[model samples]
Every structure is written in C-alpha cells, then in structure tokens.
Target: MPFENICIFGAGALGGTIAAKLAASGNVDATISVVARGAHLDAIRRSGISLFEAGADKPLLANVTATNDPTELPPQDLIITGLKGHQLAPAAEGLAHLLKPSTRVVMILNGIPWWYFHRDESNHAELQFEELDPGGKLWRLIGPERVIGCVAIQGAEVSDPGQIRLSNKGRFILGEPSGDISADLREIEALLNRAEISVTLSERIRDDIWSKLMGNASFNPISALTRSRMSDLMADGATSDQIGKVMKEVKAVGEALGANVGISVEERLEQASQVGPIKTSMLQDLLAGKPLEITPLVGMIVALGRLTAVPTPVSETILALVSQLDRENCRTA
Candidate 1:
C-alpha cells in the first residue's frame, strides 16, 4: 500500500525541495503537508512552496498544505524529517504527534543520526549514544523500528521564504539499518522516483552512511572554520591533507563498528574537488547565524570511536574547534 498522507517536518531547504518535488508530481498517491515555521510557513500558506531548479527561469509552485503546528495535520502515513541533525532532539516529541502506529519516519539530514548506532537488537545494551541523543529522547520517542536512514546527495538552499533553490541534483540513497530490502524501502523509493528524483537502495546502509559522513565530518568543519567552499578546500594542499587525516580516522572508526566505507581517502578528496566551489551546509548555516550541526557530523563519530577504542585525534581536534566556534557564536546571539 502506498502512503496516503505524507508530512514533511522541518521543511527547510532540503525538506522543502523534496516536498516541492513530490507535491508537484501529480502521479504520486499521497497528500503532502509541510510542517514549517516562521516566515516560511506564512509564505507557503499565502502562496505554495516556490521551487527553482538550477537551469530554470521560473519557479514551480508545489501545492502542499503548510502550517506551523503538527497538531493541525492528520496522523501521517509517512513523516520525512528534513531538519539538521541537531534540530531533531528538541522536536522529537512534537514530531511524535504526527505519528500513528504504522507511520514510518525517514530522516534525510546530513551526517550520522541518533538512531545510527542502535539498529541491532543484540547490541541493545551498547546502543546508547548520549552525544547525539542526550538522554535517549529520540531513541525512546521515535524508536529504531520505524526509522529509515537516508543519504541526501542533493544540494539545495532557501533563496527566500517558502522558496527552495536546487543548486545541484543527486540521488537519495535509502536503506534499512538491518541491511534488508523490505517493503517499506521499496514504497518510499517508488514515491521518490515518481517525483522524478533519483533513488537507490543500499544493502549495507552503514557503508553508505560512512561514505557520506566521511566528507561531511572532514570537509564541513574545515569549510565552516575557514568559510571556504569545496573548490577552495580541494585547491589548498595543506587543508586537503587535514581533510585526509580526518577521513582516515573516520574510516578506522567505521570499520571498527562493522561498516565498510568502500572508498579510499585520496579518492574521496578527489571526488570533493570535482563538486566545484559549493559552500558546505555547515558553512552556510554558520553564515546564516543558525546553530552549527556539530554533533552528528563530527562529535557523534568521536563518541563512536570511543566505543570501539579507535583513535580519532584529527576528528577530535576538529570537533573541539568547531564546537567552540559554535558556542562563542551562540553566546553573543
């Protein structure tokens, strides 16, 4: 059965892009609702979600019901969280209101999630990650069974209130944490495919997770610290070397925790180079004065490294610096 009602919670750039794509696709058999806040919600309610793709002159208006309150919406058949990793914990309970017994939650945010380490039942005793979950609020409220992991490879940003501009297009990698091709995964893939968004399934989602996280953990912080784009980060040899060190430590931690990243550090850096001068989401967030999403991207990996006894000094240092930057930025705000 297809999801009858899909709610997009935290409808910011990435979420808005996905919601706009889906809502514009007439063939998808679902009612798409966007739970957003502030001026974005007001704009969407006044007008629809205005989306502009890279090569297009005009924006497409996606007719999604937009509101600030989750309580105003029906119990969603599927809920996609489009918020940053740091935003999830605070909204966990509010997100719970949109869930029914059978609702599935897909988190398409960047970096490792609170649910990443707890997919295995046998290791239930070892699944607690206080760094990401902070008293296991998300884990307890959302649970692992209803959670599906996603690696959002697309790049997008809000050019204005209720407007999403897609800077680049890429596939969304979807998977079950237990490495199974279940019915739920297929349904979500079909829906996204209908939206004309590329979708792929990963047998070992952890490998895909680590592969994306490798770049995010390394490049995102460096870019934020220096306010540089991918092109600049790749151009300078010294900063590029630092990125490699961070990725190497990340690879060790991933392997220690049974994830095969399947990409070499040099190859990953080369791939980053080809992506051009894209400002990382972290850098963008910092410039926008929003709180940095430090935990899931770098801090949680450091926490995982501690669990598996893997040394992550490079990541540890980067985490400390970026964390301090976040604190000082937030202090004056």
Candidate 2:
C-alpha cells in the first residue's frame, strides 16, 4: 500500500530539507505536512518552505500544510522524526495522534538509537539507554515495533526561520531493526526515490549506525572542544592522531556489541579529510547557544563501552571534556 499521508515532525534543518524536497518533487502522490513551532512554523505557514541548495542561485519553494499541533493533522502513514535524540522522549506522547496501528516512524538520528536492542537475541536485547530514552518514555509511548531505523548522511542547516541551506547532497540509509526487507520499507524507499532523494536499503541498520558513529563520536566532540572544522582537525597531525584513537575505541565498543564498522581508522580519517572544512553539528549547536547532543554521540559510546567491558579511554576523556563544555555553555546561555 502507498503512503497517503506523510508528516515531517520536528521539521528543522535536515527534516525541513527533506520536507521541502518532497514537496517540490511533484512526483509523490501523498499529502505532505510539517509539524513545526514558533517563528519557523509561522514562516512556513506564511510562505511555505524554501530550500537553498549549494551554489544554487534561486531557492526551491514548496507549499505544504504546516502546523504546530500533531492533532491538527490526520493520522499519517509515515512519520519522519527529525528531533534530536534527547528531544524525542518528551515529544513522544504528543505525537500519538499521528500514529495508527501500522504507521512507520523513521528516526533520522545519530549515535546509538533507543531501540538498538529491540528484537535482538543478545544479552542486551530490549535494554534501554537511559542517556537517550530517559525513563523509558519513548518505549512506553512510541514503541519500538513502529520504528524504521534511518541513517542520514546529509548536511543541512536552517538559515532562517523557514529557510533551509543544504551543504551537500546526501543520501538516507533505511532499514528494519529486525533486518527484514518488509513491504513498508520498500514502499518508503520508492516514495523517497520518487521525490529525488537518494535512498539505500540496508539489511543491518545497526552496523550502518556504527559506521556513521565512527566519525561522529570522534569528530563531533573534538570539533566542539577545539572550535575547529573537519579540515582543520584533519590537517593537524596531532589532532588527526587523536581522532584516530577515539575512532579505534568507538570501533572496539561496536565490535564488542557485534556491529561491524567495516572501515579502518585511516580510511575513516581520509573520508573526513575529503569533506574539507565543514563545521560539525556539535560545533554549530555550541555556536548557536543550543544544547549539545552529548549522550547519543559520545556518552552512549562510553556507556556501551562499559556495558561490553570494552575500554574507551580516549572516548571517556573526550566525553568528559565535551560534556563539561556543554554544561558551561548552557549555564552561560
């Protein structure tokens, strides 16, 4: 069955970009809507969503129903959540109105997801990460069965209230946590492809998560602490070596938990070097006076290291430093 009603909840930055792209595509046969708040919502309501891609002279505009309340929209066939890992738990209850029995929730999140252990046969199966999910609110309200794991390799930022700036053209990797190529997954892949968004179906989404985390866990915090770009960090010999150490530790923890990162530390560093001097999301958040994504990116790795009896000395040190930095920024802001 085709998705009839598609909603982009927490449409900010990457989410907003996805919504705008889908709306502008003119190929999707679904009713598109966005749930946003405050000035962004107002702007989207006033003029729809505008996307400014890199090197594009003019922005792409798309009109869609924009609302702050989930109840104002119909029950959706697909709910793509762009909320940060920390923000999901608090908003889970409010999002209930958008879900029916078969609604699929695609979480475009970084680090280890809350439903990482769901449907797994390992000792950690069904275990919840308090750092990400907190008091199991998401588990109780949203349920893992409705989740479709997604790893987004996109770079986007909200240039203004309702305007999105795309840094690069990136693709999304989607999969079922249970490792099944179900009907819903195929439908979503086709829908996104129709909208001209690159999509890849992965059989092992957890491994994809770890593959992305290899760079995120190391570079995000390092960038935050040093206030440097990817190129800057990769250019300096000492900083590059430090990033490699952190990646090694993160890879070790993932391996202990049966995730294959599938790349060497040098290869990962080379990839980062190719991205040039891009400001990591952590660094960008720090500059914007927003709360840093500490837990999912770094803290979760440290926690998992402990759970799997893997030593994360470098990750631990970086976590402590970046966490303190986040607290100090919050205190000042």
Candidate 3:
C-alpha cells in the first residue's frame, strides 16, 4: 500500500510534522489528514499545518485536511496516532471512525505498549499491562492485531496550533508485534524514507523499544520532577549515578520478562549525557499543563517488574516522585 488515504491523529507536534513531510513528497496519490482539536484544528483548517525544523521560529507550511471529528473524514488505509500513551483511552471511541477493513493504527509513544505480552513465548505473554492500558479499554477497543509497533526517536512537539517544532531526523523504528516484517510495513518504510525520515524495520522491535526506555525510565521523570533538561540531568556525575541505578533496575525487569537488553548501565548513562540540552517530552507536557505520561513511561516498567518477579526499587522510587508531581499539579490546578 502506497498510503493513498492517510489519517494522522493528534496533529500536535510529531504528527503535524510527519503530515507536512508526506505532503512534500510527490507520491501515494495523496489524501493527507491531520486530526486535531480546539485552536490547533481551527488554525489548520483555516491556514495549514506549520512545521518547524530543529525548533526554529520560521516554520514551513503545508496544505493538510485538518479536522477534529474523525467521523467526518474518509475511511483511511492507515491511522497513525501521535497521542501520548495515556491519552489513547479517552480518544478510543473517536478513533473507531478512522478504522476500516485494513486500517492499522500505528502508535508512536514511549515506554512499553499495552500489547507487549501479546503473542510472546514468555509467561507474561497475553498479560495486559494495566499501567499502559488503564481499564483494559485500549487493548479491547483497538485490538492488538491492529496496532503496528512504533518507537519514535525523533524529538518534536506542537509549538502552537497548526505548528510543530521538529528535530532533524525521524529515525522511527517500525515493526510488527509478532516480529515479522510485512509488505505493508515495507510500504510505510518506503513512504517515510522518501520524506527524509530515517526509518528502521526492527526484527526485534521490543529490544529496541526497551533500549530507548533505558533513558526515559531515568530522564523523563527526572526532567518533569526537577524541571531540568536532558543535559542538566544526564551530564552531572551525581545525576548520572542515579540514572545508572535506575537503568540497572530496568534491565532486571526486562531480563525477567525475557527481553534481553544487551547494554551496560554505564553505557546507557553516558549516552544520555552526550545528548546535549534537549528537553524531554514529559518536561514539555508538564510545561504545557497537559496530562503527563507517567503511567506508560515509568509505571508500566515497574508493573512489568512485578509481573516478571523482578525488583525495581529505583524505578519505584522515581515513579512515586513523578506520580506525586502529577497528583499535586492536578490538585492545585
């Protein structure tokens, strides 16, 4: 499939950026959509999706069919969701409109997805992750088979309505949950690659996903809780030491769950230290007064530890702090 009809939910940052790039490419017979709400939707419908590269002020404009209601849109071959891991539940009912016979909803979120255990040989296989899935609504409403696994390495977010601040590379790792590379996935790979986004087809996407999680399990909450950027947290010897402790716990959980993450905690900590002064998505969400992704990024990992009979004292410590931040922020507001 060349994506003749495409609908990207949450035209916020990453989704809008990807929509703009797809429009720039002269392929796929092109009926592009950016599903958003409120001022963002109004602006995109009136003008267009404004895309910023490398968080620059000057943004590139691309004409996109932007709407808030999914029902009004045409049935699509693919529905790419750029929503945070927690927001999937609230939007599930609305998302049904985008589902057709062959539509695959690709989730671009950090942390372990709800469907992580589906079809795996591990004892945790088919076990629902309550942290990510909440009331089991997402796993039931959307169905695991319809979810194409995605891990976004690209850093981007909505600077404003109809505008997105994007990083240089997309580097989105894509894979089937069962670890099979299908022709459909190759088609998406071709489309995104043509748009200048570096796409990798993961044979063991779960490993790559959890590897990325090594950083998020440490930095995201630390950023949200401490209000520090990536460099500030990771570069300091003391913070790096704390991160190393967290990584060790995360690796134990991963191993107990049967996903062998082949990297030392020191290496992961050093890698984060070198990423410069980037702000995490959790920090960004906190700044914007939006709901934090505390559940999926941190809570789910700890939940995995419990499921697999692993200990996560460090992860639990951070998760408790971040959850308190979320609760206090919500309460005061």
lDDT of each: 0.86, 0.90, 0.81
Q: Highest TM-score, which number?
A: 2
Tell me the tens digit of each residue's lDDT in model 2 across 1-333.
668899999899878988998889879888999999989999999999989987687999999899988888989989999988877887887677898998999999999889999987678889887778878888988899999999999888787889988888889999999999999999999899999899999999999999999999999999999999999999999999999999999899998999888998889988898997688888888998889988999998889999999999999899899989999999999
Q: How far is candidate 2 from the true structure (C-alpha RMSD, Å)?
A: 1.2
Q: Give the lowest summed-lDDT range of ten residues in model 1.
A: 117-126
How does each model score on TM-score? 0.95, 0.97, 0.94
Off by over 4 Å in 2: none
**In lDDT terms, how accurate is model 1?**
0.86
Instruction: Give the per-residue lDDT digits (tens) of candidate 3, residues 124-150.
Output: 578886667778888777889888899
Query: Each prediction's Cα RMSD?
Result: 1.6, 1.2, 1.8
Encode model 1's per-residue lDDT on 188-277: one tens digit a residue. 888889899898998888789899989999989999999999999999999999999999999998888777899999899888889887
Q: Give lDDT: candidate 3, residue 62.
A: 83
Which residue runs of candidate 1 sit more than 4 Å off their true CA positions?
A: 121-126
- Model 2 accuracy (lDDT, Cα): 0.90
Sorted on lDDT, best first, the list reads 2, 1, 3
- Per model, state how many residue pairs clash: 0, 0, 0
In candidate 2, which residue pairs clash?
A: none
